[model samples]
Structure formats: C-alpha cells, structure tokens
Target: MSLKGVELQIAIPKTFDAGKMADQHHQKTINQQLDANEALNREIERKQLAVNKSEGMDAISEEDENDASNNGQTSSEQNKKKKQQQEQDAQHPFKGNLFDFSG
Candidate 1:
C-alpha cells in the first residue's frame, strides 16, 4: 500500500474560560436561586412556628376548660379527692382471695 493514499485529522481543544459577562450572568443566577431558597426556608419555619404556637394554645385552653368544669378546683383539691378515693377502695378489700389454691 504505498504513500499514494493517506488522510490526516486533528482535534482542537475548546477554551474553558468564561468571560466577564458570562461570569456575571452565572453569579446572578446563583444569587437568585439562593434568595428563593432562603425565602422558602423562612416560610417553612414560619408555618412550623405557627403550628407549634397553636398547639400550645390548644393544650392550654383544654387544661383551662378542664379546670372550669371541675368547679375551678385547683391541683391540690384534685389530688386530695384522688387520695380519698384510693383510701376508700383500700378499706373495702376484694371479697374473694386472689391467692386461694383450693379447687
């Protein structure tokens, strides 16, 4: 096959440098994305805080309603009532012995 038929090819590498205009555009895009993400995060945090506050308020209101229904009795009065009930139960023991082994 002599040198009568031959072919040559070459590949040129592209420039990787981004000019000032392209760099500015890229930076603007990045800043916009960051701002949008920050806003979204703030909104999420606000909603979470609102939910927490509402839940706390609901718990407080429920406790208040319970106290109101109990004739405004304080925790001490409720505790005394519970102790009295327990003492009464103890005074009246079970009729049948739980340890009875007879068939």
Candidate 2:
C-alpha cells in the first residue's frame, strides 16, 4: 500500500474584513449621540423660556408693590430705618481692620 501519489485536502479559515464592520458600528453610535444631544438642547431651551417668563412676572409684581408703597406711610418708616442703619454702619467701621498692620 503506497500513498505517495495521493493528495490530502484540509479546511482553511476564511478572513473577514473587520474595518467595515467597525465603521458601521461607529456610525450607528455617532448618530445616536447626536440625537441625544439635540433632545437635551431642546429641553434646556424650554427651561430657559420658563425661567424668563417667571422673572417677567416677578418684575410686574415688584412694580405693583412700588406703586402701592407710594400711597403708604410704611415706606417712609422703612426709609428712616434704612437711613439710621446706614448711619450706624458708617459710625462703626468693619472689624476687618484687625488684619491691617499698616499703622
């Protein structure tokens, strides 16, 4: 029995192109990230608009208070108290001078 003239066949592994698969995966993730960013931006804009609206309402209320104060004596009492506090503060300087070594 001689096997010198016989040829043997073996199974070989096929090579796949990994670069294309990686490129496809990266593109999918990038699109998802962009969509999330857009959603976040829209949310931020909505919150900012709400904040602006509330601040406008606060300004209107402050204006109304000012108008009411003009016809009340409480405003004068408040002004006198504020003036007295200012005078007291002026008379007694800040204790921060303790750190000043420059005589």
Candidate lDDT scores, in order, read 0.70, 0.68
> Model 1, 1-103: lDDT tens per residue?
3332222122112222346568889999999999999999999998877745457787678757766788867889977876886686577465554766696
Q: Per-residue lDDT tens digits of candidate 2, residues 56-98?
A: 7876787577567666567777678658866875774755455
Model 1 compared with the native: what TM-score?
0.37
Deviating ranges (above 4 Å) for candidate 1: 1-18, 52-103
- Compare the candidates by lDDT and give the number of the best one: 1
Rate residue 90 of model 1 by lDDT.
76
TM-score winner: 2
